[model samples]
Target: MGQGGSREFEGGPEGFPPGSERRSARQAEEAPQENAVVPTVLQWSQGGQSVYVTGSFNAWGERIPLRRSGNDCVVCLNLLPGTYQYKFIVDNEWRFAADQPTVRDEMGNINNCITVEDQTSFMREEQPSGFFDNNQNLYTQALPDEITLAKEPPQAPSHLWCLPLNFPPLCEPHVASWTLLPPLGVTLTHLLAAAADRSTNTLSVTQRVRSKFVTMVFIKPARGSAADARLGPAPAGGQAAGGGFALPQLPSTAAAVAAQQQL
Candidate 1:
């Protein structure tokens, strides 16, 4: 039989330094079986200026510790899935973030909101081969439930509501006032939900009956502009204007329409 060469394991079979092997073994025992994934890092900077990020996640205004490289500042933190708003504090004063719906921080200050997508769902969709690129802003995530929405829409509460094409401004003599517009762009689903449902005669209605009122809005003629003389009037108090438009005893058979020429 041929002689077998002696084997030597680096740092010993304990897989640690010889003298400190006992302590290293203790540390390995204490450590969890699986290490957590390192959080994604975000770098914020503008025109060679270093900016600091701070917001609700880090106790509102407290500066998030960052590492500077050239002009860019970076921060990494493990954040749970949900909506979060943050702002970059540049040069200790100027705050910057996307301008849209301003989000309020925990300290009641407005900050820029950023949504952290569900990581698990996003990873599942991306699969095992590809990795997330830091430079990309848009990402795709999978929703838990099937996104099937019915096309059939709900019916409007009453046929009295009108949508006026010619909207007149407030305190003006005009027909087809802006008020006539049936709360522009209000979805049929929402209006029906607002009105009382007489089917079961649910008595626990919360909203008080609003009083009916009338007003006229006049659209001032554009300065020295040639346009048709337009004026409109509509029920000012919304559905409160009960007597102005009577609800038909028989529900509208058509695709639930609001009368236009009746007024």
Candidate 2:
């Protein structure tokens, strides 16, 4: 009995007592090992023969090459929750991220920027089955007939009616006043009526006759033509009154023939 008691008091192999080994094992089991949390991944979608990412995260010293998947070259970076400025090197040439936000560095060079946030609460709140939970009941209730009806077509513009109608002339006179004017007044009235007509052929003929008459009056002013007298003196620069229509120095007979043919 004494030998068994002494054996119990003595230590076990490796100087560890029998009960101590069991106690240490229990303590180790109670204090569980903690697993490392996976880092957040950042990805880029540009594809090239060779692509790499270098940024402030790596002190701009390391070049992480992107892996090509189908048409896109992507790189996975384990980033902490913070902002980062970076750029892509494609085919040995530097490039900024196409769609990411950018900021100018001290050297005036643009760099792509990104922000990371802790996703623990986001992961917990996300619903896999009902992705749009807020909008699910929105379409369940029927809408009113009036609300569902298609909107009325927009109204036409006010000036649409003016098309195909000749614009009014810049000058006008009462009937008695026109009669007091020279016989040229009657000719102008006829010309104005022809201009206001919607017929294209008639308008073309009137324009040609009017141009020829004005050219003739300016080039070889008739001794006492009523229109020429009423027009007063020609401006110093040879520009005619009533819109400064310049009289051609040399009128060609060919142009007159062409104008007549266009009538």
Best by lDDT: 2
| Candidate 1 residue-wise lDDT, 1-263, digit = tens | 11133232222122222444344345435544343433656666553244556554443435565677676667787765545555665554545544334675334555666655555654555433434445453345866375455377878555424323233445446654444433333323221222343322111111111232222222322222233123233346522354233222333323223332243
Lowest lDDT 10-mer window, candidate 2? 1-10
lDDT of 2 by residue, 79-99 (tens): 655566677766656788767
Q: What's the distance in Å from true for residue 71, model 1? A: 3.9
lDDT, residue 159, candidate 1: 40
What candidate 2 gets wrong by more than 4 Å, as runs, is: 1-46, 123-263
After superposition, the stretches of candidate 1 with alpha carbons farther than 4 Å from their true spots are 1-38, 47-50, 98-110, 122-263
User: If scored against the real structure, what TM-score would every candidate get?
Assistant: 0.28, 0.32
